[model samples]
Structures are given as C-alpha cells and as structure tokens.
Target: MSSKVPLPAGTTLGKSFEYGIDVNLGTYDVPSWQPVRRISGFQPSPTPQTQDAQTYDDLGAPNSDVTGWSINHAFNAQVNRSITTGLYLPEIEAVLARTDPDAKGEYAVLDARWYHKPESGAANPKDAGRGFFTVATTRQNSGPNGEIEVLSITLTGKGPYDKITNPFAGWTVTAPSISSVSASSPGTNPAGTGKQVTITGLNLTGATAVTFKAIAASSFAVVSSTTIVAVLPSDVAGTVAVVVTTPAGVSAAVNYTRAA
Candidate 1:
C-alpha cells in the first residue's frame, strides 16, 4: 500500500495529499482521516467559526505557540534546495525583492495554512526538513462528532511597526489659543444641539486628535482638523484642560468650562 511505500529521499506530503485515513487518527495527519474526505458528499457552511477574516498573534509575541518553527528554519536554511522538487514555494530571491527597503528585510520565509481551518493541527508544519503544512479542520471528512476548518495565512511582518503617524508638519504647533470654550448648547430656548457645535480658536488646523482633561471625563472624540465634539462625561461638569497635540508636539492646555 502507499502507506508502506517509501517516499523518495526528499518527499513532502502536501496538506492536500491523501493518506487514506483521518490524519488526526493517523500518525502523520493524512487528509483522508479528515472530515473533508471520510464523509461522503459533505460540505461545511461558512460561519463565524470559519471566518474568511483571519486573526493572528503578534510576531515574536510572548509565546506564539505557532509550532514547527524549527522545521521552517531548517527548510529555509537549505538556501540551496531544488525548486522543481516542490521544496520552496516562496523562493528566497523573490522574498528579498518584495521586502521593504527599511531594515535587513531582504530575507524572509514562507509557510502554508489551511483554507477554512486553523484551530486544528500544527501551523507551519514541516516534515524531515523537506515538506511543510498548516492544517485546518473540515466537515467533508469529519464525522458526527468532528469539526472542520481551513486556515488562511500570509507572509507578514519584518519588525515591530511604529503605530504613530505625524500630524504636524509645516504648521507651527503653538500653545492652543483660548476663545471662550465651553460644553453648552446654543441655548435651551433657541440653542444649537451642541451635538454639532463648533469651537473657533487659533492653532486648530494641525490638531489631528484631541482629548479633554476633566478628571472625571471619559476621552473626547476628535471631529475635524481643529475642533472636537466630545460627549459630556457624567462628571465632566466643570472647567478642564483642552489639550491638543500633533505628531510634531503637544500644545499648552486651553481651559474650557463645562456649563452647569
């Protein structure tokens, strides 16, 4: 049988390769043992469990269990493995070329994932330094008590990204100008819905985001280049600092009184 047959010196059983049994039950996780195959004429419906959107742990995060790193390293270490043998899909040369010209991103590695499952089996799976895989569960072969899925993975990350964007450029980040700021509608009788009121002041153009400094207030919502439309915090009923900032620097606190 194929099970007893010996694979060539450098044989890699792809995730799609059939081994005639539930790989979960089999020693090497053969697709045959999976629900996609065992069950006759079965197809899983797409749902939250199998979201098309994939979520991943941060790279080098505390403990990205993501197993098979060693195998990945070994496969990547080959550096000179033959491509025709299906050893490497994302070649090192192409990897280096597509990288950002920032750090030493010239070198990158690639891995595979399941189409609808990721919660099962090992990710970045490798075999004898010749084959690699990322398994997902599927209903096609899973039994009455089984689960199925496929995982979608991509080659991402070279380093930690700086999540900060500069908002201040040629604009001078001077201390905020005060022109009678307060938290009150036009007037109960004929007042503006304060819900959409505007605050006019100097140095409001470069303020990308704004925050209020009322000890009891929640954070504020920045609405425009210079103005802010914040929900009144339950306890933000008094004067507080209206601080504005830009990528270049922060401005002095401008006091805005909350109407009683």
Candidate 2:
C-alpha cells in the first residue's frame, strides 16, 4: 500500500479555523457571527497603581500603610483580522461613513463579539469579547505568488471586552399578560368618567382600545407594554367591567366602579 501524503497548507481541516466575530452597531445584540480564518494582535496588560510606603518596626510587615491599589488603565483591545474577501472592503466603508444628524456624531464604532465552536457544539454557543470597537485600520494584501487577496482590518476596543452569554437560544415570543388595573393618580377614580384609569397588566403595549363595559374610552395612551392610561368616557356612570384590547388579545374584564 502506498503511503498517504500530507495535505498542503490552507487545506480545509475539520474544526480548523472555526473562529468567528460578530459586528454590531450601537448594540451588543448580534444575530449571528461572521467567520474569520485568522485573528492576531491581542495583548492584555493590567496597569496597576499602588500606594505603599516603607514602614518601621511598628508595622508587622515592612510594606505597611498601603493606601490602595487599582488597575488604573482602561483596557484597550487591539485585534487584527485576516479576512479572505475582496467584497468586504465596501461594507466596512459604508459602516465608517455612517452619520447621525440628530446626534451630530459619526457612528463609527461597532460592537464586536467573538466566539468559537468545535464539532458537535451546542446549536447556539455563547460568544466572547463583547464590547464596542472602532475600526482603526484596514489594508488589502496579496499573496506573494498569485494567491487570493486578503482584506485586513484592525479593531480597537473602546474598553475591555466582556464575556457574555447568549440568552436568545430557544427563545419564544410570549403573549402579554394583564394582572390588574387601577387609577393613575390618587384623585382619579377607577370607576369615574373623564378620569385617567391605568390598566396595569402585561403586554399592554400597543393597546388598541380600553373599554368600560361596552363603551370605549375617550382616549388611551400606552405607557408601556405593561400599562395603559386611558381617559374614561365622559358622562358614563355606574359599575362597569373594564377591559383592554391589544394585538395579542383582549384581557379578561376587570370591574371598575364609576364614581357618580
């Protein structure tokens, strides 16, 4: 039998180069990760500031009366990526050109998340290096011998990159819940007309209507997904059932007494 030959460099290996980084703008909520072959230029250093002085025999330890010590430097994470793509350059340019007119600032920095997964990994694994970063530099390079061109990007983290867990796995949208309702103000009445009655419940956001018995409120404001403030219809009196209608569904009727 002939001996098998070794594979050449850049050959695909199982579980090799399974590293990825996700870039998110303004938020660390990344939907997915972008795979990268190689990453470099990571140096971690803790610059500590300590206050200590030489103590006489009065102190048990020679170095006594130490005021305090702390890592006085903000972490600056620098990572360089070797991306195998000619098409990625334009995308980076678009991101760098983002301008917020209202804020009057360039939204250049992007949140970056790095992660790795081996074979048989969890369906969705957690990521590393969750923090905001700015693209410090980008350069395009070519192989010495007519190989594929690589896009290089250098990212500088604004602060320390934090390890974060993924909370979106196996997540599902739940229907809103309405626990209770009450008057918004102390002087307001739960069953009084023209007063703002607050519907206290879950998923009260986007409330379409707030009705006392069968009569709709004059006006309603969705304070939050869990609360709705509605003005009771004018000239309506007597005990009535209060209910809220939303896209999810109508909540069970809660009785409200309209103060005569």
- Top-TM-score structure, candidate number: 2
- Residue 2 of model 1 has an lDDT of 67
User: Top model by lDDT, which number?
Assistant: 2
lDDT, candidate 2, residue 120?
A: 43
What TM-score goes with each of the models?
Answer: 0.27, 0.34
Instruction: For residues 51-72, write the lDDT of model 1, one tens digit per residue.
Output: 1323354344343223222211
Stretches > 4 Å off in candidate 2: 1-16, 25-106, 123-127, 138-145, 166-260
Q: Clashing residue pairs, candidate 2?
A: 177-202, 191-257, 191-258, 204-225
Please give the range of 10 consecutive residues that has the lowest summed lDDT in model 1.
18-27
Which ten contiguous residues of candidate 2 have the minimum total lDDT? 69-78
RMSD to truth, every model = 25.3, 16.6
